[model samples]
Target: MPKSKFNVGDKVRLNKRAPGYYGHLLQRTRTIISIFYDDEKQGNTYELGARGRGGSLGFFRSYMLSGVSPAQASKIGRPKTKRSYKRR
Candidate 1:
């Protein structure tokens, strides 16, 4: 796959089935705080908003950004088409 064009400050969301550390998953809208590529490490980094547990920081692979921003959330990968989706 090609590298994503997402930049810092862009809003984004996560997929329920998206992989994470320790066999866990997340599915929610979040902000893109940072993006990094580590050729030596052979991977990428994508930091997101804080988690629910006491404002814990959340980080995931760039692939987690498969979902779109809150602004375009309604028109992008929104599993529903019947109801009119609105950004929060």
Candidate 2:
């Protein structure tokens, strides 16, 4: 495979598979969390994420991604979650 040109905030869709995770990937556009390099640090890996639906209070990572662009998704800032009320 050739080197991927995707950036950290790229938006992507997963390539359709036969059965496993074929359609599970969210249709809504998701923000790229970050791109990771292989353990050997030779090439790179892609990490895609999005906010959970229905106020679930969490972000979700995409199992796989395709059909998108690195310039589409905006860069991510710090998380906006508030501190919990429970004490230490």
Clashing pairs in 1: none
Displacement of residue 29 (Cα, Å) in model 1 is 0.7
lDDT tens digits, residue span 1-76, model 1: 2375677777666664465552433555567667777676667777776643434246667655575735543456
Worst 10 residues of 2 by lDDT: 54-63
Model 1 earns a TM-score of 0.50
Poorly placed runs, candidate 1 (over 4 Å): 1-4, 20-25, 51-56, 72-88
Give TM-scores for every candidate, taking all chains together and pairing residue i with residue i. Answer: 0.50, 0.44
State the TM-score for model 2: 0.44
Q: After superposition, how far is residue 4 of candidate 2 from its true place, in Å?
A: 4.3
- Estimate, for each residue in 1-88, the C-alpha lDDT of model 2 and write its tens digit: 3456666566666554323543654465665566655656466666556454423212322334555644566559965785669878
Q: Deviation in angstroms for 75 in model 1?
A: 17
